[model samples]
Target: MASEVVALVNPNTEAALPFATTLQLVVGQATEKGRKSQNEDAIGIRIPSGLALITKGVVSVISDGVSTAEGGAHASAISVSNFLADYYSTPESWGVQTSSSKVLTALNRWLYGLGQDYRDARRGFVCTFSALVFKSCSVHMLHVGDSRIYRFRHGELLQLTHDHSTNINSSNQYLTRALGMDVNLDVDYKTLSVEVDDVYLMTTDGVHDVLTEFEIHQKLTVLCQQHSTLSDDLCEQFCLMLNKKAFDLGSKDNLSSQLLSVSQLPKQAIDDVYQSLSSQPFPPPLSVGMKLDGYQVTHTLHQSQRSQVYRVVNDQGEAFCMKTPSVNYIDDAAYIERFMLESWIGQRINSTHVVKVVELQKIKSALYYVTEFLSGISLGEWLTQHKKAPVEEVLLLLKQIELGIRAFHRRETLHQDLKPDNIFITREGVVKIIDFGSCYIKGVAEISSPLTRDRILGTADYTAPEVILGYQADGRADLFSLAVIAFEMLAGQLPFKGKLEKCRTRQDYQRLDYISVHQLNPMVPEWMDNALKKALNIDPNLRQADTCELIHQLTTAKANQTVKDFVPLIARNPVRFWQVISIALFLCLVASLLNN
Candidate 1:
């Protein structure tokens, strides 16, 4: 048996998070042939360092080769190796499930192709695979076939994976699903909340089938009593002991086991999600040259009813933009949470076209966040300065903005409040997205909170029709907003003749109309205008799949509309799209009430 340990330490964990405690873990793994002539079981653990350690977290994988297959051993080894390598190579912005699933899908395809050399794939390369990913405060597990995953918490051992093999009898059994066994792989994915002192166990059937859960619990309990920690030596000894027991019990398969001990986990309560900043008192209204936490307010850039922005400079003379929630919302839980979410989300996103959220250097004495300041003018301001920009320049600006939006989308986020006023263009012509106050994060939204966390609407003019119609929105909603911006930039007017903002009901949406860019700007090509029209489709279903596709159409002349379909009231009487939906909903409500 062999053993290794990986210890993770995040230097900026607290700076990036509101909580002081970060994810800390101790990992140990072991494998042995036990009564078998060769060990077809493979177990490996990868605990990356640096930023990846924080974003991708630690991955532990195990695979059991089917002895009946000619290349079973090779398949198991390759699966384990490929998963670790490919998973880490995926974009850091992707969530754990997306990154792992895509890697596994590709890995399975490669292995399945190799198995085609045999008349029966079962007689070629085949293996049962299981992987445990420890990310932030959650554990994501992916499984195929009979390998098992378990968790030992608070002195109890609980099975976390199900066996995929069917039990016709003790002497006869067959795997229902496994990697490289079929073209279409159906893998099970499971996610669980993690806490301190949690020890997760992964094992092959050689040890688990021979030992009941209770027996495993007893053995785990003894290990806990004997050692204060799941150090490399202790974890290796535990695996070796399990292998010996299974061998003595007449087990005939290879043995492998892996252990993960969660030593520290961030605070779980939503209120504590950013407790440090959220608990800080809102700073008093600032005047020019006023200093707070060593940052001097050189100028108040902008102030709205909801928040305030100021250009600030510190001792090092570094220029930055600081944003503060209005004192009016100091007692508003929802608003405060939303305000906090902006800073939290900003700290994680990394894109040149996106304003960078600066990590807090000194202890903050007030409720505010800082971002790198760039000398730039808002897109709205720029639009007013130039009535109609060159077609090439407009496309260039749109392309940069798309990059920023794509960065957010890659992280499963949506800039719900996309608009001209919320975007900035540096003197160098670099477009940077700001104002994440209305942004939506898929992972963060799943967190439990007692406060009524609602979708705060963005600017009505740029907000998608679906959002106004009270429908669930995704990236398409943002695309709709981007399309509106693109249209406004080209024609120097709103698509529906500035009537979209007045829309309230189905009738108003139905009355909506589009003003072609060529009629106003004349310089916009027919293809570019068509692309913008498609993107501004009132129905999200009809809009471009993503911002990149929309940008592609504008830059590529051949990307022309190839099909025709009836758009609802919005396309014809554009203002009527919003009204049609509201009126229909109102009539439905009346009918239901009368029927009741």
Candidate 2:
């Protein structure tokens, strides 16, 4: 019998960050010219509501103008204002770090270009910037100057940003790093957990450098109290007093201060929903003429021992694929949770190359979910027709696959089950990755669960050796699988002559040798074959670090390429290999002496 299909929606709408979601924030900021003619410092705070609040979160930034620069004020203002605009403008699918980094990189370049007309670039646009992104219950911090970010929590105040200036004879210091100082911007970045009632303080050097850390703590202690409510009046008063206090403490430079206090955070309920829905009983099987909920089944696409997929249409005549879990494992809680997460993960990943989970407007009465129906052929089926596709064609398709995989990676997800069957080429020639039953979400992994989540996912033929041996899976695992697919496309057969699937142990995998693509297809170039071989290495550490590197190797060959027939024992680490050999020999000698 087919299980009723109902796509589970994550409460946050977007997948939650590593922890927490839907943060409510109260913010305030104050700035002063201090004895300067113009306030060369800038500050801003943005709190988005609704789904964006969960995905993009709140952003706060402060930038300090270089004291010696001619356009410090303009530079500071542009950095903070443009960052606020560009950050949220970036694809919502991007992680906080990625979005900020890209914006900063582009912002720096634009600022640097503005100063190119002036002699002695230091006399032009330049500033130090510090930013804090509060998303979910996590804080992503990015800094490039002496501007400061601090957190007041549990009755204690902690500084979160490092001062980038180096001391000159302990008496004086000039800025060593600042935005627009060079063509490349190197910012310090990190992610940390944020708790309810957590208070964040941002400041320019005019405030932080003059006022002692103790003084800042005193202000935060009075401004932030234990509660789910935020005090705008008190928070604003704190910022004004902070900037004024710095000026009163013999400060001569422009000053700015910003405060943000978390009022409430969404509770961790991702796994709870899974556990609750998992208790729902499996529905009886349905045929082509039968209807489950509003979806009317038109054809049974595929059926397996674990699940069944069918083409169905809604009352509006919109086509969709309804996937139902099999009744065989109705009592298996872990399996059911994983099955539910499949749709949840798909909803978070927004990419043209990925099949999206469609949310039916009607209420579901059963346990099945639906996805977009595509009139296309699976990569497995396409491969059967074109045994030897052109090199350019394979590279183009592989890049698209990599692009799709990145959409999941951005959400801290891993498509652990990646094979030709899980990939589809739509009628318009778009490559779409489908099926997330074996996917891993880093945030979900952090949640403590009694049930074992790891048990070797994906087909053994393409699974990384580390994954098979119970090691934590990462991007390298996906890269290995991608390489296997690449080899299959070029050679029309699996590498290692299909012996990889039989590997049940480390020794078994060690015994298997990789079959060169060149041996199977002479049309393949030596450099391209070498690149594939490296990606297909049994030892994942020996493979390309990422898909980008693999793609580069495939598209651009080395000046003097050398083909390696196999990955040597020393490929992973020669020093470690010799150290193990030395240890083994010494142990053998000790055994011989004991026996004698």
Q: What is the C-alpha lDDT profile of model 1 across 1-596, one tens digit per residue?
A: 11111212123322223322256688777788988899999999998765566567789999999999988899999999989999988755467888887888888888899999888756878999999988767889999999999999889778888899998897878899999888788999988998888998899998888888889999989889888867766777777888788888888889888888887764455444435335568888898989998999999999989899999999999999999889998767678767766877787789999999887755677678899998979999999987778888888899999999998998888889999999999999899998899887765553334456777889899998888888878899989888889888888887888888889886677567777888898888888888888888777788788899999888987637444445556556544777888899999999999999
Local distance difference test, each candidate:
0.82, 0.80
Angstrom error of the Cα, residue 510, model 1: value is 6.8
Alpha carbon lDDT at 243, candidate 1: 78
lDDT per residue (tens digit) for residues 296-357 in model 2: 99999999999999999988998999998899978665677777677777777899999989
Which residue runs does candidate 1 get wrong by more than 4 Å? 1-31, 44-60, 66-93, 102-126, 132-139, 145-187, 190-251, 256-275, 315-318, 332-341, 359-363, 446-454, 468-472, 502-523, 559-596
Using TM-score as the measure, the top candidate is: 2
Q: List the residue pairs that clash in candidate 2.
A: 1-285, 2-285, 4-367, 4-368, 5-368, 5-369, 6-368, 6-369
Best by lDDT: 1
Give candidate 2's whole-model lDDT: 0.80
